[model samples]
Target: MSKALEPAGPSDGVNRWGLVDLFAGCGGASAGFLATGAFDHLWAADNDRWAAATYEKNLGHEVATVDLLEVAESSADVWAAGIRARHRGPICLVGGPPCQGFSSHVKVRGDSRGRNTLYGAFVTLAIALEPEVVVIENVPDLFATRNWELFADARSRLSDAGYRVRARILNFAEFGVPQERFRAVVIASRADHPEVRFPAPTHAQGAFSSVQEWIGELSPVASGEVAEDDAMHQASRHSKATLEIIRQVPADGGNRPIGVGPECLDRTRTSHGGYTDVYGRLAWQTTAPTITARCRTPSCGRFIHPEQHRGLTAREAALLQTFPSNWHFVGPFDDRFKQIGNAVPPLAARRIAEAVLSGGSHSEAGVVEIGDEPIGSSFSVLIPGIRRRGGRLAEGN
Candidate 1:
């Protein structure tokens, strides 16, 4: 539990809409909502202590470090009751549950099932709180053949609760994020209110904001250099061998050199098929790759700086994720990168909040088809164990 870095109160006399954020990592989505000047953050919760601390520091609000799955299973009514008592206006519930299960980057089957159903906890809170609007965000793989049933089940539950729901896969770059990150988003509105519409793209592919425009102006630092004025701008120190490999790779969008680095990454290795982005430098004029929790190192992905020989610093990564330069992330270096990588870009989130406030086109009251099997099929059998386990989806054969 960390104290807010500043006073935690909304401005006076605005009559802003209320928002309750679950899985509120570093307040990224909440930042977007609040940036619209149409919402006041009433409550936010996440299990990560450092992330909660970061949220409190940057958002000027306290975040409860509670396990949402436990709360949804045993005490949703109790929790929702407290929120309801605090605010009596129209409320929007927004969250992105642990999404590793639905991410293409995850290879292990066992690792995927545990958090796959955490969105159920989100649904539980939505049903209990009865928010006027509900939003769920996750990796685009949520609509894949393997995970579609779980997504269908969540949508079915929301629809049964009188919400007109629609799901879409949105690229954050189109919404002005300087990264080519794709996420599946579900927005639901109560039957009485206008359906929640997805916002139109604000930036086309060719005209997207570039990495140069975002972080190029920051003071340059070598691999082991630390900025005295800003801890977030400090770059990670790399090994001598790693530095040699990065130096060999051309600057500005260079791929891992063949037969040059570790033998494990060599073309002769059997496991070196699809990892083209490993040890690669980002292109200055184009959008950066999706920043992951491991983005502080070059071995993880194409996180190496465009011209520098080290991976991206936390500040650069945060800026690529559309977090404001002044947004303070509280934690050790690794923890700060994790918070930034896991956050929904505030710019994209602002568009979503604005769409909710705009009362745009009324979507139909069911799942939006983006190439998946129809709901209520034989796949329905997969959902019971998820609900019974509280949140973890059963390992299906």
Candidate 2:
């Protein structure tokens, strides 16, 4: 669902903070930085041509389609050199290296140990470029027991390079996004700068956004139907049998009945139950589950629409992830899904940037204890209370 590319914003030569996105997946992080009005995107690099192209289209920013390994190990260093030539000052470096190799959900054909090396590539580039700040985003498993070695190495390297680094796991739903996506974020600043802190949650529990809140405005489309007006609104085509099975499931967050479809049961291999999210529908009143790269396919996750018998459209998924409805994604259908799913939710990233630039900690009462606090409480009041030893709140008088 590609749209007309907007012209890039003209630089005003105001010495704005510059940013370089290494694994810039379709400008998700860049969009967040731009929204803050405190930074300018100087350059973006991603090995995926489709991702880089989509980034260029939406942000009108120059994206270098290059691999990080080559940038780290090779003597050519063209990518790094080009940034130095243009930006000239200490720029911020941000990226989330591919997480498939380190994700807990990925159980076969990969090992977290092998993927740990990629973090080194980021560290190497950071040292070479000497950016004022370094930010790395990845799955929460990157800090889990099995992958702690990699996380430890990243910390040691940043310390050796003279930057003070800290890591936090942030939930998108807590930041007003309609989807439930958790990411491990590490922020490192030059030793002399104020220590970086995780951004505080702006919304909590019932106050969080729901699926209907984000995508309710779009017109409904049946399976295989494309809204000619909005390309992204087109639905994934399913077979007649598939549609029948989807229709049988109860609307609003219902899982496919066990043994109802061979394709859904195949994963269990003769067992009665398995992945519950497959062929499931979203609940209009609740937040969406994590929007994966394969979310456009019903079998990927709980991607089916609440009332519609079809998987989520690309635009719907993007909106659930807090992307602007007008922002366009390039490439064919599948690639657009990958770009959108892999992106950091812009709203979450904006709060992070605000905290980082202000030298303030995003320390809120609770990280994301959804459903614990009342919905109508004032955010200003929520910000100052600290959690006591017994997990009770010590409120201000």
Best by TM-score: 1
| Candidate 2 lDDT, 1-397, residue by residue in tens | 1111122354466656788888888888888777776677887888889988888887888788766765676743565677778875457788987533334323553544443355667777887777788888887666665566566766777889899877655666777878767666888898876676667777776666889888887898998888878888888899888888788778988988866776646668447555777788999898898888989888777999999989989999888877788878889988889989999887777767766667664464233222212323232232223223221123331
lDDT for model 2 comes to 0.73
Model 1 RMSD in angstroms: 8.9
Error of 1 at 263 (Å): 2.7
Q: Rate the local accuracy (lDDT) of all candidates.
A: 0.78, 0.73
Q: What are the RMSD figures for all models against the true structure?
A: 8.9, 7.8
- Please provide, for model 1 over 283-391, each residue's C-alpha lDDT reduced to its tens digit, 9 standing for 90 to 100: 9999898888889899998989999889899989888988888778888879999999899988888878878888766422112334445333333343345336432
Task: For candidate 1, list the clashing residue pairs, or say none.
Answer: none
Candidate 2's TM-score reads 0.81
- TM per candidate: 0.84, 0.81
